[model samples]
Target: MERPRRGWEIPGDHVVCMYKIIVTPNASVRGVASKVIRYASIGEKEARQKQEYERFNAEIISWYETSKRVGLVMISYPPEMFDAKYGGIASLLSVIAGWNVSMNEILRVKLLDVFLPEKITKEFEGPRWSPDKIRRKLRTGGEQNCFLRVPIYPRLAYPEDYEHRIKCLLKKAPEIAPDIIADSELLFNHEFCSIDKRIDIMSKFNKHVESMMDAKERVETKTGCKTLFFINVSGKPSYTLEKTEAVKEAGLDGITLNVLTTGFSLLEDLRSKFKNLIIYARANAHALLTRGNSVGISFDVLAKLFKIAGADIIYTGAPCGSLDRVKPLDDHVADIRHRNTIVRNPIYNIEPALPSISGGVHLGNLQVNILLAGVPLQITVGDGIYNFPWARNNLDRIADVIRLFKKAIYIITQRKENMWDDHEFRELRHKKCRTYFMEEGKCVDPTDKEIKDVLRRWVYPEFRDVLEKWERGK
Candidate 1:
């Protein structure tokens, strides 16, 4: 699935948009290659003939390397999306054919991957975590992502000069696993404690962690999620420990910690204390990826490393949305996960964790997102859902979008259980899904597999294509 590139503007309702991506099909399967063409659906073979068709068994890898566009992939959206004022899908073809757009000139890049809630570049727009509402809106039984996010802001503000605001932030968390994204102020606030090897009760942050333990019951009841809070623990570690311990005691599930900024041992300590806590590992060194370093571990490897350090999940920025979309960088993400398989570190016995797709994810990229993130995707949308100008009932709409995404995932991935696999969450995805939305008191069957197929082919794709075209450059 593709994440929107930065600098490429968009609108909430508009359907079609032009997308540019760099793909190294050579590293695709060995890296991010989604499917093998030799063994493809019958109709897919015919479609392959129409566009750029590589040798059937000669390998898609060859086309990836030899094409003068040599990994350059630019596609136009559905034709209906075009107009004289705003060119349609075909216009994109014309632009690429006539214009010479350089990778360096593009400001944003969308990193395509399987998980939501991954890391994002600072440049990518509202794709940034707003400390507001965003993400999937589940309204039917079909739509359900194991993790359902609820927005909870810092209820109390710390004095500008106060040293303990970070302490206060951790203190306020009712629960911590759904994953929290705070502004930088909350991330590096001097008042926040560091991760400590030994848990302490006397520390102000420690006290907050202990306090949240009591509040856990209330939080669990309120969100109906047992371990669903990711606190603002972006500061350094020993103090990060107090935050981790607070997470442990409060039964809060995770915290977003910058892995590159802190050592792996910090995560190790937190993992040691709480066997089940989820850590959202953030890595900032991914900037090197766009330059085409296939061997370096890159940010994707950081996910593997963090998992070794005890992170439950890691954030990989998007090719677009909150960051510029760079095709080469997207290839690097695939390389990190596929090519650089993490060797088990002697530091600890660890399992393969999940990668998150963060930055500017919203209702718009649903299908392409699943395609890009791969199955079992975890995407974070800070403003995409909340920032809608035409949305009438924003809350319900968000939930509806979430539900649609879940249903879409189910349909697209062809999996029945485990909406969130790595975390192994089961019932959580069900929370957002309602089997039916009433129409005249009669249950409407919107999700019967047959009807769903009809809608996807006959409806959704067309409509999505239509609006996306005009959304470009918005």
Candidate 2:
């Protein structure tokens, strides 16, 4: 009769949102119990009564201190606090990232993970094109046939330069065809080379590549697969929408979005607008949000969010690449595995996103990447392909590098031989040539002793033949 005490009113059958957060207690705060405070609106008497009716109040599900300063807590909130359907990702972050008034006492907060209920997970139309569907469409058969992606880089000042590169790459498409060719994130719309001009050039080459593949299909079973060309479409909402419309009209394969730069909501809107176009989410600026230990969200958590936002391919940094310089070997590997697992694992009705291992992948380290990330993955090489000494002087050699990359993947995945014990393989392994990228220290030459060592090892006997034939320019 008191009008439910203004803001303290409780509704029947209210859904609860669950979250796992890591918090660093302020110097004044004492004990773990002090870290787990309930929402101010939820009175003890009302909470107890709601529990009896199968409805729950905002409360700490679990809590434990990992260190003197840091503590891990699992908390639940009433529907009044957050609603996935109406709130979306922004509101979800506001709650877990400690923007709530109840979290004012905490010094530092890091969102480790979130366990959303089915009702919530279903609201997000996860990835429209699952990794398996992508593979099938690309004609990439078998688990061993990993998807390869290369980028157009070094900054094209003019549209003609961009067209020239595409022509060169497509001319050698039959020799070593890659699954995807994307524009760099830095390569955005400009007066000198606008998105429309780039899309026009790519659309023209797309037809040529398709024809080349069609001709090769007569002899090679999987050789005729259509290569997806993804243009960088990250910009202002209106501009991005405009560029995407052009890409769709041009019938281009896909478009890339810098998720961290453009925001998750943009990715979701694009997926909703374009049902079939592949969305490659690039989190190049993730380190600013995920590099800290006691602050910011974890990479795994961000990766899951990207998947939920309908990213068909998410860039999970490669363990053997530049990520090793920033993150520990173990952490990098764990991040890669976690991203790979969540995208493919069944969750409500969400489709799986393809985990991309990029950031310095080359033929030298290609085998280690395949070993680390496993099957149904995308390996993207930018500097690895474009910076190759041979390819720098001659565009034809770009196809040769791709051929070597394909052979390396095949040998790693299909061959059953134990090359680790062979003397030449062991020497090559010791040189770290099979792990480090070109820019990390030294550039790997086809004539390098380490490469010759791999050949001499004859570990995957068939690889030796491929290398010899490639050397002969056959």
Candidate 3:
């Protein structure tokens, strides 16, 4: 296995200077990366020279030149820019990115990584519940806590859907208890779900949460293990505050906030405002892309930001998952989990945040993900467990999958070397049926034909017409 490594070269002066630069839409007189600095300074003469000569030099951020249009330039900032007394993650970022956003029409700044001084880390609280506390609280399958998340597409869906989903989970709660059962971001409160302009948003939301709470009680009664249910509460500050209050009032365990959508600053606010509720920060490619052209956040930088903002758990890319272009996935996971690894800044002792492996995770790739991301994990699988070929059988099949998943995880975690030689491991093949297309050891991107085939196979005779209509429209 290749270990993660970093290389830094500083001149004799020991000045912290050099920023990796990339150009966006607007082009300066020359195709050089210095133009990015021009845009980053937003054409401020004094600032540009300081950024170029005094503060730092330029180096390209990317490893390769994918395009002549983009240049990765490194820049170093002055020490005086950091104010120790009023130090914060947001303030530090503002120093780096303040003028850049307004610099050019499409000039964007994505932080590949940041060096957090002790002064900065001490500014905000880290995770309240570390991995140990979380496992202790949830009472997982064995020594390790396996995570499960069920995605609910609609609150207004038919009763049987919830029954089959929640009730089935309730039945399996006792024997195959997972540490966390989170709501997918898909099931968030949206304007479309509201009934009328006159209707109070929280009133409708409270009604929906009531059903979830009732279901949670039933599961806890059977399981004895207190399984936490996190509802995806993401929106504007006003809407988010109202829903968060409603979630707390309803006696729910926690709420999931889409950090990229709500912004990192909002996460800090929620962390301060609601001390009791467990805040889980979530983000996907789609959500992050919507953050605006000026703002670009890399995987590791995003992790540190969440930690600084006080998120208990943050989702990371799976080594072999649906999301693409996330190379060095193992390194990204480490960036979140390992303390004092981001940089050797003397000021603050930054703690580790729980790294969550989600997206296209299943029984097939459980051990593989563990090996890549490292153990003491929060693995959230959706279709891998729920959409299993034989999962419909409430009593036996779901338990079987859970047991096998735990078994594989246990072996790999206990014997790290076993990951290399699968000959020692069992369960080489899957017993369940699946409608979606997938590939081994990589994320599945099913072709159009494969999707159509799955739809035809799974859809009932009555629903075939609707499926065909949708397909035709596509």
Candidate 4:
């Protein structure tokens, strides 16, 4: 049988928005060539006969050529040029980013931004579960005064080459429990550890699936808190989908998708197919992030695009913790999540996509991360808990780490005078409380440098060894 169509395809008749982008030429070009063809006519002899066929559709809005290496050109197009029905992500891209990439020799035309119309955004089913729903589902503990849903995702590994890591975590669940346990993104791709080629992915993943279910049981029985377990489904598109189907059939909670590895178009396709499965889109900085450098796409644009494409949770970079000098990126991501009205497409009542702050997040700067990322955020940490030097041998000590981190988050979010004003964490607070705060349906602005400095100061110095290891490996 013919292979099933991998996903959605861009048809020729889809309706699109009046999209525009700025194109910068590699070298200065003549004015005639700079304009994108809109109503080109062939030679006089064939012009009459081929009038209908010869019209190349696109309008050049503006052009600025300052020098040989630097020049800017703006292009606009009518919505009728795109195939609206079958073109979800791919169709939209064909107009915005698809063709211009290959034209680098003549001009470095990059997509600075697009003003998407309501007609286009309405086609997507944005996040199925909002931040509040996710918080209720996972039940990361806090009070009314406490910022309710700052969920945590802790990356895991099978240390003993068995299901020992998860089992240990479940046994310690009575004391400390993580909101979500996630497989390392590289694990599914065989980069973290080599698996026997003979073993099918289902067989390799079966034990983890069972272990996650077992952990769920223990958490419910002991702590009464809910937990979500997401397995990394990373690989070629077809293979990843196969794994996803197996996980869904097995009753696992979700899948962690490295969107960079799978392709953004594929991610949207999966979202359409697996409506119930929670998809965590991790922008691993391998694909879109690198491509974004050449184009003008920043983390902010990428995050909002993923949301429009129906991603539930997106990995929105780390600021001042493990990765350095990305505070602006993080702030813009949070802005998209909380202030969806400002940055999102206007047609749909799309719930704000949850922005997850990852990369070296731990108990030390956990409070800082939560504050900076804003409430209703998701926090992901790996080495911070697993490789804690003091708890290297004792798995039970993870409870203390969770307890302390939650305590810190609660104190900072609630701003309880008695709890932190005179406490040790008092020093962790910014002298001016520089954080994203709600005001008139928007986040109050704070300089990226100020937030970065305060968060850096709050980082736990004890984890220097772990941070050093991450830097070296990176």
TM-score of each: 0.42, 0.79, 0.65, 0.67
Distance from true location, Cα of 137 in model 4, Å: 1.8
**Which lDDT tens digits does candidate 2 get at residues 1-474?**
111111111233232222233434444323433334333334445655676633434556556555565556655555455556656676666655543424655566666665555555667878888877786667654554578887876666488777777666665565457778888788888888888888988898888876776776723433325678999999999999899999999988899999899987888889889988999998878888777766677677787788877898888777567663365455456556666777666566677788888876765566555655756688988777776655877876777666656655655555523334335444544563444333443333344554444333322343444445434531
- Please rank every candidate by TM-score, starting with the best: 2, 4, 3, 1
Q: Which is the leading candidate under TM-score?
A: 2
What is the TM-score (0 to 1) of candidate 4? 0.67
TM-score of decoy 2: 0.79
**Considering summed lDDT, which 10 consecutive residues are worst modelled in model 2?**
1-10
Q: RMSD in Å for candidate 4, one decimal? A: 11.0
RMSD of 1: 18.9
Write down the lDDT that model 3 would get.
0.51
Alpha-carbon shift of residue 172 in model 3 (angstroms): 3.2
Q: Model 1, which residues run further than 4 Å from truth?
A: 1-227, 288-297, 319-324, 328-349, 390-474
Q: Worst lDDT window (10 residues) for model 1? A: 114-123
Single out the weakest 10-residue window by summed lDDT for candidate 4. Answer: 436-445
Model 2 segments more than 4 A misplaced: 1-56, 78-81, 101-104, 141-144, 214-224, 415-474
Q: Could you tell me the C-alpha RMSD of candidate 2 in Å?
A: 9.1
Candidate 1 C-alpha lDDT tens digits along 117-171: 1111111111111111111111112223333332222222233312232333233
For candidate 4, write residues 1-474 as lDDT tens digits: 221121111233222221123345443443433433322222334644665744435556555555455444445545555554577767776655554334444434444445455556667766766666666565544432222121222333333532445454544443345566666666764544332221233244445534665666624322225546676777888888877887676666677887766777778778888887788887776344424333445444466667777777776554425553433654444433333322222224556666676666655455445544554456676666665543466765655555555555555444422223334434433332223112121121222455544434432343333333322422
The collision pairs in model 2 are: none
